[model samples]
Target chain A: MRKAYSSLESLRGLCGLRICLAGSRPFKREVNSVKSRAKRLGLNSLTFPRRMYLFAAPALALFLVFWVFPLIQMFFYSFTNFNGINFNYDFVGLKNFVNIFKDGTLGNSIRNTLVYTIVMVGASNLLGLAIALALNSNIRLKTLFRTCCYIPALFSAIVVGFIWSYVYMPRSGLLVSLITLVGGDASKLNILGNHKVALYGIALVEVWKGFGSTMIIYLAGLQTLDENLLEAARIDGCNEWQLMRLVKLPLISATITINVILSAIGGLKAFDYAFIMTSGGPGKATNTLMFNVYRIAFNEQLMGKASALSVISFFCIIIVTVLMLYVMNKREVEL
Target chain B: MRKFRLKPQSVLLHAFLLCFCVLIIYPLLIVLSSSLRPPGNMDSPLLLFNQFSFASYIRAFEKMQYPKALLNSILTSGASVLVIVLFSSMAAYPVSRIKSKTSRFLYYFFIAGLIVPSQMVVVPVAQMIGRLSIPNNRFTPMIMFITCSLPFSTFLYAGFMKSVPVEIEESAYIDGAGLWTRFAWFVLPLLKPATVSVAITQGMWIWNDYFYPMIFVTRRDQFSIPVVMLQFLGDRENPAQWNILFAACVLCALPLIAVFAVMQKQFVTGIAAGAVKG
Candidate 1:
């Protein structure tokens, strides 16, 4: 015991000396490494018992049984003619995929999903960044305003979708009421009912419920911007716009990447608004990929085809996300 | 005159922010006011409180079976978050501490789950649930919630676990403390912030999620808050029971909003920590 105490004391003294000699973080990390190495030499212990793996067993079992196994089964089921009811099903070998494409469902849903993603990514980021900038400034009631902004985000998508549906209701909706009160023609203002406008309308609801989170993230990023750096930029006679364009945007490029990619991924999985508000409605105009999968699987009872569509969606999401991350990372480095 | 001399840019910024806040808050206020008015009264949306009453709340409360649904929501979300926090934190302990290729691979394996959208697996999950003869109960969605949340929560706890210095655990180990005791007493307490993050994020999601429950639990009694609120959707009998629908919406949102009111700072911090760090 005395020997162990002496060894630990010596190691602490060594770490102290190293900190005094080189005050850098990496240097300090090296000191920690040396101390840990000393521990590995048996002054203390570092062995994770085999039983520690049991700590991971519950989650792993759950993941394998519920998530991974299901995913694998989905890929397999996609190749077969399983209608979700019968046990006897044959492997069709790409026929389900071919059917989706041949039926125009794939093209329409993909187009809608892409458009919805684009709208969400554009609108949410812009609005969020704007609000984040405004809130980050020396504004009165800032917390109150921020909380109010986030109120919509706190509500479930069902509530948001329901409220927005009512807000966009045809004649006596809040929107139409406001437009009429402002003396605009409100006769033909049906957002959720119009095939061309339904997708955008639901996308707008998502934006409303979503931008607050984006703003919160952007605010967190902006708060990390060095005060001295901003002051230096201002001291260099840069105007507000120039400072924002030249310094702030570049500084928060990483945050922008995170926000944009998150929004895009979120937008790609757009189902709640479509499911609740429009029900992929107004003649399948708002048929997002996720909603389409739901419709195919449950409504049409074509689980095999839906599985195929899900596989396609899985690949599509992975590809789009990877591409976005790549492009955003490139822009981040350039900025 | 000096006191009134606000900068033009500052004024413009405030004005823009104020208008934006109004735009965001007005719709919510409309819902609130519509709920306050008597049922079957379709007044102008412009009216705030021409006649205030809780009649709609009473009606919505009964119709949506708010008590039962709220209990189911509370049970599923609360229990799922508890188990998720425990399991993920435990799982992260080994992944974060043990230095091995397997550990590294396991870490990335869980992280990869963040990219795979849950909808991709829903079809098979449904089929599996059916084949397994899983009952449409609260635990069904609870299990699904736990499974889905594992990856993110594990990643989060693992990130935080790295920040916890190993020396303490080593010292505890040297003091003849076993792994379970050390983890439960020392490491787990230190991971409280991570636990809270996992809880809040996963709790909010499980509480608000209707999709999984909508798919898994078809029974009316087993329905969660959001799923139960679906009754108000397209109610063809009344055609325009806006008051009851809006009232139900408010009730569905009230619990979370109430929690947010108390723990606003934590909510923001939780989100920021998850997003920025993760």
Candidate 2:
């Protein structure tokens, strides 16, 4: 993405030029309209330049209303004991937040989400890196392989979840049938029924659906590798495994960090597979933070707690993301 | 000399990859097979092309209100693509072209939306939409689709625009072309690839997206395909209606996959470049 348009660039000489025509007008201006008239005329007059804000008004309106406003409402409502449908609710004063801590499912949900994140992020990136390495080799029909690898990702997460539910559908499911075919006597297997395995089972599908994109990203990153470096390492008597560990791995550390961070964030907020595969399970085994937020808000009608959860989730996501980015940035070698 | 296929490494790689491909495509094959079968709990894991039929597809289409749902999805996603492309492209102009102190600040301000973890905002957005008395409306999600999509779209457009030299617009200015004219005639044509990338990326996103639609769209008729499919998958009128449900799943996925097939490279390239979503 950092590489600028190579062959596909259509624009000739329009970007970096001084957009202000010579001797036309200064780009910035200090307007001196009457103060009250300026107030009546609006804040736009005092702020952004006409053309720039004209270009940005629609998007900013949307950004303010849909994204920014709701977030404020979410925070304020989190402090209240508000039911979802009505405007009548007293200020609960951390009651909802306290209840969240006391709520057993909250702890369970957080743990399950962490477990899901760890397994999904770990398994998918490792598997994705492996497949990327395999496809990165000199091979026939590489495009076909790439497409096939990515087809699962093309399906909606809901659809993928539904399809995998069929795959894990106890005795008659494809997975069970496959196991039975190998004389494993797994016909009565109920992967989604057992709380112990259900989270991981759902995580499996998430990994399955997600790894293709990870592979594609890795593949693209691999293409950017300096081949002479690899050849030099080989000439230094590095074997295939040594070359991978010493040359390929460290060189692709940037890609590794990127893929890990993305998949980790994805895993932390994973809802579709958990919700669809087991309906948050035979128990609340797969109840992720997002899914629990949905359940509380819509199902249980505890909008206050849900709003609190959403606020917590927002901060949790931001803090973790920033920390990961900071740590990764610190660790990234200049090479 | 031994044939190239005789290499142990090549054999191992091919075997691993072929098996991997089958695993990946197997559930898809099951969907295809089940969509062809009569309403039944399919027990077999083996794929049977000989049993293929479209009877389930025909019934599944009606049961899921496939046509209406499809139209809703198309209208919403198509509108999202157009809105994002237009606003973001227009917005990209002043941000990229005009070198000023505020432009950098504006760029970061807009791009900050990308970090807000959109799913977190769903709670209040749903309630706010309800308060606005437009709950269950398509246009509400349209606002969301645009808002959530803008940061990346604007980023991409601005990035692409940076490669475009400012001389062309200046030349157009010399010829007495107004801003909108330069934008419409000269600038938009120059933004062809960026526009398509945004359209393809955001369009697919809005189409495949189920969460927002599931929350906002309450009526059966208004439900997008994914939302409707989820509703029905839970209710299944008959226990043996797995085939029809699978058929619905297939139908829901087919159009996007078709879109993917035609614009495979763009879809992949857009995703790899943008990383729009967390």
Candidate 3:
């Protein structure tokens, strides 16, 4: 038995040696055959393993169940008179949409949301760009100023809104106190209470909390500007204003696009301040798209109406986003 | 020695920035100071560091159920972020690796969620939550957060995953390493930067978002920090106690501010990186 085992082991070793002597070229040929075979069979084992797709199944399942399904159901509900409490509701068709339009809710919220987006996109960009320019330059205490400026952005909207409501409070508010300190008459400074100024008031609060982040993005983009190019421009007799307008603006167009789109989207979702500070009040003066949705859905118990409103806003948002992206991309390419 | 001379332009820039900083910071300082004043001191002067009392803190703490809300906030947001990172990276892997029609469809499918804001679908989602009898608890809000975050998180992960060479993964696969093993060992470690971006940005949103919790969580004790602060909103019947409300705001914002103070570089860089990349 021992002799047979030794002879078997030697035979195996001889086979291994023979295979090694001949294996290298055949191995390459075999791999190439496998590759060609896989290609012919439309089976890309290297890239498209059937087993690999299983990794995405969990997230995809969650996405479909939680996100896609809900959105589809939202569309369905927009057509029915589902009052949120009852499961047995009738199809109302276009009635909800017509009702919202006739009552002026749609037009009012759209106008207010547009105004808010304009203010946010305008004020946030200008202030953020200016701050970014100043901070990007050679300045003292750069980190300290940046951090302090960003502190408000760190706080929750609830906190920021609450604080600002107090600031905009009547004679006892901080704005009044500041004006008094500066020797200005401060009697008629009820910003949040006045219907004409209420929307602007909340929009400014949005800007205050948002501009820091916008500034940071602008600063990042500004840092990428070539210092040598600026120096060369300076050598060619470009003033600071000329340098900024001519050299800096064109280079950072991408960042401006990003900030504008972000602030626009954020402004369109203006609910928290209107909800917290104004309660969509001063006679629906600050009733934004989102707050109107909340008011109709929760307070009025009109889920169908709210869903219709949401569908309108959804189309509005998607169109606005696509349009902005197209226009901005064109502008960026042109620049 | 060089003469210490301030250039006029530099001086003007500094002065303007100083006023801007003051404008940004003074309101927060007012909240801080008002929170420290004695309870019922609504008429207290808006000066910094004038009072040394925690009376409002104590009152607000009890009123807002500080300990419970803080624990809920930490647990929910932390769990949501952990799962968001894991699920999103896994989902992004195939989308990035495979070159097929299905993969392309899935990539755009996830990216489509970016434009459709969650509030647009809140009605049906809320109804589905009720109809399905999902328990309105802290974890419920976590599910909402994770679901809402997956779009951007997956977008981020997919962008990062394209940069990862397939050679490493293929080699590992040929070496008899299984899919999960290769992913855990090879892909995840290399994805540390994207992971940090995901964690910081999504973590900040989940932590600060009161909207989801306000909609989903019905139990008072299950309220997150921002929702708990909502309790201080005074209606006509009950006037807002300004001091206590300010105190609650401070308490609510304290943890994030502390984390930011420590991880300022990470927070700033992570957000900027995510924004730029996305």
Expressed as tens digits, the lDDT of each residue in B97-182 for candidate 2 is 76555778888878777667666778788767777787468656787889998987998888888877778877887798777887
Candidate 2 lDDT at A280 equals 87
The CAPRI class of candidate 3 is medium
Chain B only, TM-score of each candidate: 0.94, 0.88, 0.94
> TM-scores for all candidates?
0.91, 0.86, 0.91
Error of 1 at A161 (Å): 1.2
- Per-residue CA lDDT of candidate 3, range B123-188, in tens? 778767777889888888777798888989999999888888889998898898888998889998
Model 2 residue A264 CA deviation (Å) reads 2.6
Ranking by DockQ: 1, 3, 2
Docking class of 2: acceptable
Model 2 lDDT tens row, A123-188: 999999999999888777789888988898878888887788778877677888788778898856
Worst 10 residues of 3 chain A by lDDT: A43-52
Off by over 4 Å in 2: A1-50, B1-6, B45-47, B97-101, B131-135, B166-188, B235-239, B275-278
Q: Residues A1-335, candidate 1: write the lDDT tens digits.
A: 99999999999999998987777777889988997887577453255754677899999988888889999999998999898888799999999999999989999999999999999999999999989988988888899889888889889988998888778988888899999998999979999899998999999999999999999999999999999999999999999889989999999998999899889988998889988888899998999999998888888988899999999998898899989888889888442
In angstroms, how far off is A79's CA in candidate 1? 1.2
Model 1 pairs in collision = none
